[model samples]
Target: METEQLYREHRSMLIGLAYRMLGSAADAEDIVQDTFIAFAQVSEENVRSAKSYLCKMVANRCIDKLRGSASKRETYIGPWLPEPVITDDGGSLEGDPLSRYVHKESLSTAYLLLLQQLTWTERAVFLLREVLDFEYDEIAEVVGKSSVNCRQIFRRAKRGIGEAPLATPSLQGKTMELVQRFAEAMQSGSVPKLLEVLAADAVMRNDGGGKILAATKPILGADRIIRFFMGIQAKSEGAYSFAFTEVNGLSGIVTLKNGRPHGVMSFEVRDDQIVNLFYVVNPEKLTLLQADRIRPIA
Candidate 1:
């Protein structure tokens, strides 16, 4: 009963933490499940502060997983983006109250990529202290570091990340308006219209994980990106349809080819311009999109 209650309360939070650490929702889910199973083994009377204990277990497990998978990610083909967690996909997550507890902004693909820059321990300390609101002492326990060392690690991580990925709530409306305009421009087949919302130095990255077709490198600059999109449109016209959905808690577009997952596009808006675009078409990463029943815009 205690383990079940703990699972009900902490499963979502643990998954969120693990996802941010590993950048794979599927792996995060697996880690959370494994953690709960381990939790069930320990006597309840021996556990102090169940939340802290579970978080520590999950965090350590994530650190180990990241270390073990470091070479795989380093050797990953093409541009690598986090596996997106879709919220508006008419899936269980859309109505799962547990999901509401996860911090949406921190889950953004951009943010998760920034986290990839940090070392595994640094990521753990920074996330525990900054994102999860764990105290220095608590973070220290989780990472097996002294509180002073944890603080130092966090400071280094802060410097590494530099700035937060998600825009402020005030800019959110503007971001959405720009995304709507972007979709309209794509549908209208107008390069000039697409250029209007894109920054001069806009970048689009496509991740295929070597399992599907994608750009081997980032498409740089607004003009180049627009040209690339136009080229794709000309070649695949009517073969793909796009639907607006929330990807990693930000306005994003999901492309469908014949009602199957083609790609998932997430954006980063700064100063009301689309500055960074991430297109994840890797068949492995599109599993969630495949499961969701999305109504494409005609």
Candidate 2:
């Protein structure tokens, strides 16, 4: 297949992989684009299993990105968070594994922040093994480590993120109804009502990626979480705005200030209550949420 044709076929899935691995849609697009450019430069014959080759290409690029250290993050503006992406297509979560798994994976904004607590290697290993369900050997190859090494990384990564507490297998129909209710409460300025929709031990985590003023640690429990949310609203002085967005195939909150979006918040739901709240305020990752790409996809 022509490179462009192959690219179109796998672009969405490739972006999905990079987004999960890097936690930024923009970054994923950049990484995938770079991979394709490199592939185009090669003079290879018709390749069997184009999808696998494409995956390998994207994986290698992600690894390269992990290796090259970037400059220091800026002085934070406020609570740094991960960039958010649209994962859901306004459809029921009853399709492909990747599309249906964010809620169950507990990959809401909060979980992504917990991810920040880990080193890049740790994060990569955990994403591949736990989130993507890659075999130890496959993850080992992707991460350029021995299977045993990948296993150890997964164990530590799990411990670091063990605070994700919630039970699932609930219908998306039911969970989405509750998400809508929670968004309504926030919009209507019903702090108490909003708190009522949260889990008893609900946790809030914002990832500004050290470039913005964000909670340095996870804010736990209903009371603390409520106080934090209320405090933010008070500081905004009613200028803050929000919307319910479809992110990563899960329903999430997109928060803005002065009509410009600053963060994307998503949920971890159990039964009918939101168990964890995730907010991504990190500008670097926020590129994933952009409505326009610098260069439109081919």
Candidate 3:
């Protein structure tokens, strides 16, 4: 097959894998582009499976990126959340690689942060086996490990990461209503109403990347989270307006100030309550969520 054809068919998948691995869509695109450019120059006959070869290339590059950026993340400001990818709401992702891939719960900010707990190699092995469903032999080839080693690594990574706390599909079906209620409560400044939608032990994390003010540590408990928001509300003086939208495949809120992008808030829902909130205010991360893509929720 021609390299251009291969790229068109697999670019979205490749970007998905790299984005999960690196948590940076920008980095993911760069790595995939470089990989395909390198792939095109290679002798096609020598490459047996283009998909597998591309997967290996992207995965290996992500590993290198993670290792190189380890120290930078360690010194990052506030809690680290994955770059927010504003997904389409019954529309086209058009210019974004995440359009086709962000629907999976694995692409959610909460789940991606869980993947951050694993070592670079373990992350590669686990994603290959679990997310992509690559066979042990295929994963072994991708990571340059023996099939036995790949299996062991995957098992270990699974144990370490544990299960994500995202809403199950059945629960997810009710998320829109829940988020709507939450938004209404916020707009009305109804503390009691807000409490109704939040888990008692709900936690909120803010990532400003040191560019803007944000909480340095998580605010635990629904009450505290409410108070935190209230404080921000008071300070902002009604400057921030929120719109309901899809974020990382789940119902979330996009905040705009002065008709410009402000931040994004993605939720983890379980048992009809918002259990965890990932708020990313980092301007660099907010660039993808253009004003035209968001609409206010009434």
The candidate scoring highest on TM-score is 3
List, residue by residue over 105-135, the lDDT tens digit for candidate 3: 5466778898988988999998888777899
lDDT of each: 0.80, 0.67, 0.84
lDDT of 1 by residue, 1-298 (tens): 4888888777877887898888888888889999999988988787767888898999889988987988998898999999876755455555353245345453567788899989888888888887788999888877778999988999999999997756445555676688889988898888888989999999999999999867889999999998887787677746767787767777788877776668888888888799999999898877655445455677
Cα TM-score of candidate 2: 0.70
RMSD of each: 2.2, 6.3, 1.8
Off by over 4 Å in 2: 45-48, 69-81, 88-171, 288-298
- Quote each prediction's TM-score: 0.92, 0.70, 0.94
Q: Total backbone clashes of model 1?
A: 0
For model 1, state the Cα shift of residue 187 in Å.
0.9
| lDDT of prediction 3 | 0.84
lDDT of 2 at 55: 67
Mind giving the per-residue lDDT tens digits that candidate 2 earns over 1-298?
A: 7889977666766766776666666677788888889778766664455665666678777766655533332454445455666555445434433343354544555566677677878877777777667788777666668999889889999999896643233434555677678767777778788778988888787777776767878888978887777788887654777666665545666777776777777777776788877777777677545442111111
List pairs with backbone clashes in candidate 1.
none
